[model samples]
Target chain A: MTEQRILHGADMLTERGRAEWDAAGVQVSALVDNPYKKDFPLLATKPSLAFLDSAATAQRPAVVLDAQRNFYESMNANALRGLYKLSVEATEAINASRAHVARFLGLTDADARDIIFCRNASEALNIVASSYGGSVLAAGDEVCITIMEHHSNLIPWQQVCERAGAKLVYMYVGEDGVLTEEEMRAKIGPKTKVVSAAHVSNVLGVENDIKLLASIAHEFGAVMVVDGAQSVPHLQVNVRDLDVDFFAFSAHKAFGPLGIGVLWGRHELLEAMPPFLTGGEMIDSVTEQAAVWAPTPEKFEAGTQDAAGIFALDAALTYMEGVGYEAIQMRESALVHTCMHRLADLDFVRIIGPADPALHHGVISFNVCGIHPHDVSSILDMDNVAIRAGHHCAQPLLAHLGIESCCRASLAFYNDSADIDKLISGLQHVWSMFHGD
Target chain B: MGEGIYNAALMEHNAHPDYKYEMENPTHTHEGVNPSCGDDIILSLRVVDGIVEEAAFTGSGCAVSQASADIMADLITEEPVEEVKRLCELFLAMIRGEACEEELEDLGEAAELKSIALMPARVKCAELGWRTALTIIEEEL
Candidate 1:
């Protein structure tokens, strides 16, 4: 007989707490079958687990974790604050990481200085909404965005428009999930000053034609802002190619350390906009009554930055580079295709976003007919299949789509067929658990 | 691994909640919302003097929220004011695993949701109706 272990709880879920493992290990017979699965420690340890919420946050690889530890072990100092060797090294690490991110996004080395580190994409977007929008926006002007914006992009503009006495406009999508040019033209008129959109929808997994949106915004003499939080992980997004005025993304969503986000703006725009935050190291010179701020990136990075997270982001970009865009896209496409086909096989399942699986960029949202997503999610959890079951922070989009909540299973290149199969079976189990009587 | 957790009492209460209806001009009403899960309920109570004349709820939510609302509405209706408050306190405490065996026994069928304390994610769902009921009647008392 093989020895087994029981994990106790003050009041363990009699059902879920029944996870018992034999001498080999916890659910050894049920470990996920994927080469990439081994790279993520959480997936590897929880072998039967299928994490399909990359749009929320992706799991970190060993290299990214090591990069964070190495930064603290070797040279953990405040960047741009001291002349000591350790501090200099920290500053250089941040500079190198910024350059790496710029190059990854196809920005010129000179444009590297335009990248500002913030808490996350939400904060990055808030900076633009406050500093840039606060400066350019005037009464009676209009700020146009899509009905499908994540709350991070939507709320900032909504509040900014309200504060500036400007009207907030929206570009609606058809049932096909595409924002037509006619709608764009109607909404983005001469009075429109800002046009912000998500490059990829976190809920729909549909890619918006941001290049076209940027051109139209430019035609109207408006600046375009792209929320690349969802796009950066799945696609090869080039900032210069898209030609948007500002771009924002978070590091944690790209398999990097937490609390690190990037906001890249045109150098001239960033230079003219007042600082979003005020503090030490962001100023060139300070007096009792007045202060001269530092140039570009440093002017925006006010407080003590996340030095270790910045250094670790360098590893994340390097890892993505090593994987190459072609391979990442191909692998993720196959996963999504297989998943969509299998889910369609279940008649009870109704997909929420784009009907075409090919159009999805590593994300899928659906609902089991007549069953609440929260209940669906709880049943799936019992089988160790994780998914997001809520409004996805896009209340406007959900209201527009006429759904209170949905189940989103976003994939990354690391996910494999075993994860998809487990998810399908878990969903079937959910259906039967509710109706098996 | 166990069977009783999902079937019968839980699923029946959710699928066919008899008390899920809007009360006409209720004596007290409150909207309970679990923002994260999108669980929302408008709990309505019709009270006369010191006794609850009727209790009902109208909303959408997960199985736990819907079932718990229906169950709580069924148990609290036609009960005295002070007795209703005691039952609500007992039910909430029982779901939280803080109430003793005797207090849990006083909770009637709501004690079936005791497992929710272990399932931390659903604790809010189970407490939605009781919390709303407590808040609506709290000021008057």
Candidate 2:
């Protein structure tokens, strides 16, 4: 028996099994020892850090940092302007970033033309609500959104509905954070002109069935808009397969830099809708009185774009592609399963979403009995375990769950079993601190 | 676990808060919410003949916030409304760690929350009820 085989102590093993155990030990040790502390330069300084807040924002890899630095140092110039070679390089880099995002989202060339780069997912959702839903939706029209939507998705529709004299219909989520097919059909009626829901709920961590929701919307002649912020990073999302009319996500949440977001809309809808924001690059021609807007994406991208950030975002997408969706999904699933199983052992830990980890992707929300989530988070922070606590910007959903707030431990591809162990210990500490055990 | 921000006095007040109940009839009731953590409270006061007759609070919050409100209610009851407002200002200052010994002594057990200043994130949690009391008193005046 080899050293690794003896250390793990599985069912009586052969020589070949011992060798495989040795190799597996090396791989797991790399993840357990360093976790994301090495891959992401941000955590390099904190050797024993445990970051379980990836649901808020992920730590960027060294490559993403290097890509941003390369853009600023080597090809620092304004994109889509100037005739110099440097300008052309900068512009090409931005376009390349767009192409990378399109390929990552599995969009075709025609669909790629409809992709609009905005500030963040909130801006992308606003673009749809203001430009498309605002102009087209008339009085008596209905906009359907789920109760589990973040305020970014909820408030915008509320504003649009009030301004247009339209009605805002809500589809309720079950106790398990799932919308039934019956609820989808019932809420989305003939008067429904737009249907918006998150592909995966940030707080609930439950992945919604976008294909089914889209089909229901299409039957009513309503366009389907998906908030892909919580889903795109953890899962393999093909926009074409989902057949969603509009999909919005933040680059920062997907291991990319901040100030860069993506909005993927149907080409036909982009052609029909007016521009969201108008400025220099967005105008094809201007004669003081009359200004002709540029086509599709350019008409929407106003002001100076974050070219360096876009380059970093492209690097992030490239890094994700290198890791591949299958590997990412498998790693995240195992980690979440370990977490759910362990948290389940603690009776005080009341999980807010689905009981099964398979229903979730990379996030878990729970609250400890007799301890406020804020207090729990504070105690955990003392142990160097970073977690998110509060309404998670889904107050309506929290209210529906009969909780004011919850403590969320979100994972990433870089996290491992060690991180989960640390979280469990931190939670135990919180309980002891509060309950005086 | 025994020490730090969750001190003995805070825990004592949180576990068996003397003033954590609704008043039979209140002249003023103010609802306060800390949107950050969802710490909410309903502070009710009975002011009659220019004197604070009774003060009570009912809420769900962290120990610091709920205990702080309970302590405030206990200290301010039966005092003149003007004196109650003065005590509220003193308590707020003490929690911010800006009050002198004489000012803190005026606040009674609420002065124990002076350590809250160290935890800036929780300063709001300790002051939600106090701020609500100020708003109610100001409206009455």
Best by DockQ: 1
Native contact fraction, candidates in order: 0.57, 0.46
lDDT of 2 by residue, A215-242 (tens): 9999999999999999988988888899
- lDDT per residue for candidate 1 within B1-141, as digits (tens), equals 243346578889998899999888798888999988889999999889888889999999899999999989989989988888899898877766779987777778888888888778788998999989988889755
Q: Is the docking of candidate 1 incorrect, acceptable, medium or high quality?
A: acceptable
Tens digits of per-residue lDDT for model 2, B40-73: 9999999999888999999799888899899899
DockQ (C-alpha based) per candidate is 0.45, 0.37
Once fitted onto the true fold, the runs of candidate 1 whose alpha carbons sit more than 4 angstroms away are A1-33, B1-7, B22-26
Model 2 preserves the real interface contacts to a fraction of 0.46
lDDT of 1 by residue, A1-437 (tens): 01121221212122221232122122322223345677778878887788998999999988999999999999998888889999999999999999998998898777789999999999999999999999999999999999999999989998999999999999999876789999999899899999999999999999999999999999999999999999999999899999999999999999998999999999999999999999987999999999999998989999899999999999999988888888777677767766776687788999988887778998899999988898888888877889999899999899889989999999998887678767877787888778871
Docking class for model 2 is acceptable
lDDT (C-alpha, whole model) for all candidates: 0.86, 0.85
Chain B TM-score, one value per candidate, order as shown:
0.94, 0.95
